[model samples]
Target chain A: MTATLGCVTLSLADRLTDLTLSLHEGEVTAICGPNGAGKSTLLSCLGGLVAADGGLVTLGGRLMRNVPVQERARSIGYLPQSPEIAWDVSVEVLVSLGRLPWGDAGAKIGRDAIEEAIAAMDLGALRNRRVSRLSGGERARALMARVLATCPAWLLADEPLANLDLRHAIALMRRFREQAGKGRGVVLVLHDLATAMNFADRVIVLDRGRLAADGEPAHALRSEVIEQVWGCKAGWLGERGMRALSLG
Target chain B: MNRRLILILVAALVVAVPLSLLAGRVWIDPIAPTTRNAALILFELRLPRAALALVIGAGLGVSGAAMQGYLRNPLADPGLFGIAPGAALGAVLSFWAGYAASVWLLPVFALVGAGGAMALLALIAGREGGVALFTMAGLMIASLAGALTSLAISLSPTPFAMSEIVTWLMGALADRSWREVGIAAPLTLIGVGVLLSAGRGLDALTLGEVAARSLGLEPRRLQARMIVGVGLAVGAAVAVAGVIGFVGLMVPHLVRPLTDRRPSSLMVPSALAGALLLLVADCLCRVLPLSGGELRLGIALSLLGAPFFLKLLLDMRRGLA
Candidate 1:
């Protein structure tokens, strides 16, 4: 499935004007931008959770606006920048919420899907524990597990790696890669440009709500592109697939 | 739904409702039941009062659970939406207008007030129906209704009318006939149906608004359901039983520990628990020896709820609950 954004413009005072992008299944894409650069906004628009003031978003072929809400939810899984668990439910219970779009959630309908998501997030041991008792990293994984339980065609997450430790972060990146390997689209909003360069198949950089760069990591995030978009002198260090950002 | 809790509450209610009839001021003996007005008291008087208690209590419980879920705040209550206050304001107006002499008009007036409040709340919150804005609108309406009710009370034409208003506002099921039961039951049932329909949406909200919306939980639709459900259920309760307090606010908390802790999971159990609590409390009110008269059900609950609230606060403080 292809999620297409055509000249999508959002007026939030920090305008996202005439931005067009396409995301494909079976690939990992990263959206990188400075704060207030419309990264989350763009992701929300693509997920059909927010309506763009101008232009259109098409999921596969149908306009996202015209897509039924439950169908859209079934097709797209969205994780907010900092998801909150309102109730102190068990991790298993929390993860089962992803199956909500399928209806009969917490029942036997999506049991296998929930198990797969819980396994993918490595939350087997902690399934019975309350979300309120989980640490920040654990909570983040639980939130991720909830989205993954939906088994949507497209997974759009904002700042998904912020609270993870190195091992968990690496593990999660591998998990995301596995999802993409299974012919799913993985779109993440990343503040870590190095991680985007190292892990993402495609990177799109937004500057002041405009598309500053869009392509392979090496080309779109070249030293000059970084300097021009970020307004700072920076250079990429290390070899491909393990790149780091070195500042002057 | 917590099956064990439901069973326990239902069993307890089954026992308590019958015993409540026996324990009232006229203590009817089960064995050798040959009292002059035993049949009249049991069938006509206590039966309807007990039914009203159950209906109103269950309504309050479900409303409280739904409100807490919608706000994602444990402290939210049926009164938060201003429907109860709006109903009170309407009833007070009836008294102030010297229309309290008419039985049907008072309840009709209160129902109209509740509808008006529901409309104003929806209008103020608008289509987005975001939680924060919805809560703020509720507060605005509640405060306005409260001020207006106070004004009506203070400026009541006669001391007799003022006394009647104060006593009624204390909240009770005393002297209520099957008529109150008829008015409250259908409304509460329909209201519960509406709230139960919003269960999935409330469950989705465990992940907060954005993620819930992503899960196909429409905020505006949920808000509309809450407005209508709470308006009807709580409005009917207050219209018949006066401002019976704390059942909606307290029942969910009392039942939450027994359930899965999900908002949807807590709702039915809360309703059962609320019914049980109100029945027992109303029973105690009927039997309690007060020189002035039988203890008012509203005062009885507030007395219980205040301490429960303080304990909840302290438990939260200690992270033990």
Candidate 2:
């Protein structure tokens, strides 16, 4: 599905305005900003989890505002920040819930989809294990598997790599890249600047609820913008292609 | 630990229900033929009482598990949300005010009261997203219902009315007939159906409201359907069996560990465990000798449940820690 976010705007109390730009398909976008910059809120509006005061979101040539919530979910898979697992559901069963919008009729994680998701997330060992008992990193991977089970046209994730360690975090980013390559628009909210630059095809930077920069990560990560908005000095550390920043 | 304990408990309950029935006022061996009165008592009285206990117990267990999962709080109970107390108050007021001249009147009023409380609580809880606020409102509504029930019982002119109210409050299945079972059976089944239909929503809700909404679930609609279903089942059970406590609270806790903390998986097992727990408790009430008279099942459950509740709180604290 071709998903587009057109001139989306949100207003909060105390006269705060959040202006977001439209998103395009076949691209992996990373949203990055300091805390309380409305990065998550932008993702929420895009995923149709929250209503916007202005702007239209159209998917596959139809206005999303007119589509039902469940129907919207069928085309869009979302992961909110700090997602809760209300019970100790097994990983396999939890992942299977991604297929709920299709009702009983749709071909959900039949053996093939479930196996593919588990193997993709490297959660084959944990599939039968209880989610509550899994460690933070393991649980995050399991939740990712759940989102993948739906096989939506777009994937929206909020700080999904927060709990994952280095190796697993890289693996997950690669997975997102792979999904994006498969013609799915993957929108990610990332706290890690290094990974966003290394993995994201494009980065959308927000500053105090407004879109500050939207383009290549290298352009968005300019020294003046980083120094002014983040109050940090961006530093390049040698041939490793790793960028570091020092908060003044 | 979970699987072994469930099996043992189920076995004990299976054995104990028949044993309790056989060891009643008339001591007749299941194998031996004694006086016709003994056989009649076993067939007509004890059997039906056991059956009612099982069904109502299972209903409370499943409903309680569903409620806790729905609200995402272990402290929540049918009474905390006003369904149980509301049903009880409705039945008692009907009884004391002489509105229930016929059997169906009490059940109908009780169901209505239960449904009303659910609607009111849903309005109060759903508007406010926090779990604490929802439970607090539920507690307040329960208190209000409790006060009304007490006042209605006190104002009764009948000489035996106060004792009947006390007995109902204590909760008993001692003399419950097949008719009461018939009334509760179909309603409880309906309630079970409601709980199962919402099972998927409950599963999604575990990931919190935002996650659930993103998955396209309307939280308000799910809350309405769930509360109504719980109230109907609990109200019907209360209308027939009086106000029994602990089944809803204890059964889910006992069965949750067995399912490895999956609320969806716990639903069926919790129901089974709840039925067995109530049956065993009722049996103990029948066999355990009290110097003055028969021990009420509610008192027995409270005696056991108080300590279990403390343990649960400690475990929760440790989890948080």
Candidate 3:
């Protein structure tokens, strides 16, 4: 399902204003901006984790505000920035939590989905491991599995790879790319310009809470726009055919 | 096998109970097999005491595990929500006014007091988001209610009543009769049923309220069910055996790691562990040189739990740092 956030405005006692930009489906949309640019907040609005003061958010042609949380959850999967583990459940049991919207934890489809998601994440060996004992990269992958197990039409991940090593980070982005290729709309918030250029199919750059740039990664990473929004310089780099930018 | 633990617990119950029946101020040797005296001691005295301890321990342990699982906090206890102090107040007031002399009077009042505390805490915690705020509010209310109960007990008239009140506050499984069993058993069973029914919700809650909400759980509704269920079960326990400490606090923590931290699986095992712990403690109170010493079960639990609690606090502080 496609998500639409229109003219969305957020205010913190009128001192900070976070402007909203709209997003669509079946594409990997990366939200990038400088500090205090409200990139994460825009993603929250689209994920229905936070309510916008002004405009409305609609998912699958229905107003999100009017839709029930369970109905909304069925169509949208949200992963917050720095997701907290509230308890020490096993990886398999934790992933099984994603199927809760379908029915009881003991339901046949719920169990099958949990097993499939764990297999998809290549966590078969670690399914029985306690979440507390998993390494940072493994934990990120496990949570991705959990979000995927929900089987939502849209995926919202906020910095899904911030704590990962270089290799693991790319693998996580690649996983998102694969999901988008499977026709699931993926909206993620990231600050890394290099990863956004290489991985995101569509880029939505926020500059001081406004939509500074929204287009193909190559077009959105233009030298002047990058310098203006991120307070940095952008230039073509290396044999990888990727745009590289330096944050000043 | 886990089933072996259940068998051992049952056997311990059988042995300790008869031994308790034979002891007391008047000794009746079951080997002699007397008609009136043996029957009286078995039926009226030790039978009730043993049953009381078993049921109360089982209820506290089950509810405690349920609370910890529901709150996703190892430190969470049935008493964390103020119901213990509330039940104590109700029981002390009933005794002071001489109403507790009537059968089931004290239990009824205890239920009311516990229900009131549970309702109050649930309402207050419901306003604040997250488990942390809920626990903080519960602790505050418990402290307040405990202070009020102390005041009421100090002002009681009968000199003997004062000592009785003291033992009750410290918690004991002494001089129980079959009537107390009749009052506690059915209520506790019903409470256990309610908690078990909410097992799926508890599983969802461990992932945090936002995740639980996303998973089609109304956290507020679940919290309400937890408060009511725990209050009913624990209040019945308090009504029969005073305020036993730590079963609810300790059992879940001890078994969670063994059960791989799966809350659904931990519930029954924790209940079993709780029953075993209480039965052992009660047996220790009977034969272990401290029999006539007005031994408080709460004192024993505190002696054991103090260091454990301190260690847990230190670990939490380190983690936060």
Candidate 4:
């Protein structure tokens, strides 16, 4: 299914003005921008967690605003930035919450999905451990497993890799790739330009609540565009791929 | 582990009920069937009191657990949110208006008061406010309600009515009969059922509001159920037992480590623990030697619960540090 956003605008003191975008299935799209670039706001609108002031969001010819909330939840899985687990429940129980939208039938279809997410995120060993006791990276992975367990058609995560170490971050990127390979849309708000360049099939760049560039990673991360939007000098480092050198 | 803890609590209740029945100021033999006085004490006085204590305790515990879960704070409780004091003011108003003659009017008025406090709390705190803000709002509402209750007492029509209001505010299960039980039980049960139905939604909330909404659980609906359920249960309990303090606040914390800290998981255990705690406290009220009158149940709970609240505050301060 294709998810399209047309002229979506949200006012948060400052405004995100007339932002338009589309997310295609079987693709890993990275949303990259400087701080306060409205990346998270854009994702929140697409995930239906926040309503836009004026615009339309449609998924497979159905207006997102018109869809039942449960139906929307079944189709879109959202992981907020730095999501908190308020309880000390076991990882397994926490992950089981992803199936909540399915109601009682979740027990029947949820088992395999839970197991798969646990295995995919390499959280099988820590399945029974209290989520509060896990290390930062481990907790991030556990929370990611929770979102993945929903097995939604589209997964939209805001800054999910912020607290991860290098290895876990790469692992998460690979998992996103695998999800895309399985015909799901993977959209992430990322800060690391090198990872976005190396991993994302497409990159959408935003600057100050406006879309600056949208296309393949190479074109979107072009040195001039990066310098213009981010106000920084950037270069293609051979093995490192892309690096921001210095502030303009 | 939860199953085992539940079994142990149930066993303790089994032992406690008999102890409650037999250990009052007037000892009644449980085994002897021929004693007329024993039958009178067991069936008439102790039985209803014990039953009332158990139900009210259970109500407080479950409501406290539900409040904590809904607010996502360990310190959240019916009293903390002003619901208890609001209910107290309602009962006091009923008495001041000379409606206390009807056993039913007391709880009904208290429920309305609790509901009013909840509405006022929501208006002040809003849906998105943090815990500190919510607590501050509750304190303000509680203070307002407390002032109103004092006014009702000072303006009472007769000196005897003023004394009755004072005794009621101190909280006691003394001289309580089946009539009190009849008024409180069904309302408390219904409130408990409403809270229990929101268990899964509460569990989903542990992930925070946005994630919970994404999971197809409406946080607003959950909040409404929590407010209404807590209002009903706590209002009925306070109407019957006067303002018994801290059982709701302390019971959930005591049982939290034993169960999964999942908010939903804490409810049943908290309820059982609450019943046990209040039953024991009521018994202690009877057993403790006092030069003046019998120790009030409210006084006993505050004595125990106040220190715990202080410790909790200290721990929270340390956590913040």
lDDT of 2 at B7: 76
In the range B56-175, model 1's lDDT, one tens digit per residue, is: 999999999999999998888899899999999998898976774689878888898898899999999967889999999999999999999999999999999999998888899999
Q: Give the interface RMSD values of the models in order.
A: 0.5, 1.9, 2.1, 1.1
Candidate 4 lDDT by residue in tens digits, B1-321: 788888899999999998998877777666765556887888788999999999999999999999888878888778877889999999888886677577677777887888899899777776764445667888899999999999989889999999988888888898899988998899899999999989888887899888888887876677667767887889889888899988989999999989868887889888889999999999999988897868999999999989999999998788630
Give the winner by lDDT: 2 or 4: 4
On lDDT, the candidate that comes out on top is 1
- Model 2 C-alpha lDDT per residue in residues A1-248, reported as the tens digit of each score: 11254222222221125453567567888989999987787777678776655554566656667777878888788998888887667898788777666654225435566677788889988888888789877888888888877777788999989878998798788889988888888899999887887788788887887667888878886777777678887754433345554444
Task: List clashing residue pairs in candidate 4.
Answer: none
The clash numbers for all candidates, in the given order, read: 0, 3, 0, 0
- Each prediction's DockQ against the real complex: 0.89, 0.61, 0.48, 0.74
Cα error, candidate 3, residue A102 (Å)? 2.6
Q: Rate the local accuracy (lDDT) of all candidates.
A: 0.87, 0.76, 0.76, 0.83
* Structural similarity to truth (TM-score) of each candidate: 0.97, 0.87, 0.86, 0.92
- Tell me the tens digit of each residue's lDDT in model 3 across A151-224: 88888888888889998998888889888888788888887888988888778776775667788887887677
Ranking by DockQ: 1, 4, 2, 3
Candidate 1 Cα RMSD (Å): 2.2
lDDT of 4 at A141: 81
lDDT of 1 by residue, A26-96 (tens): 88999998998888888888888877656567876777777899998998999998788888899999999
RMSD of each: 2.2, 3.9, 4.1, 3.2
Residue pairs clashing in model 3 are none
Off by over 4 Å in 1: A1-14
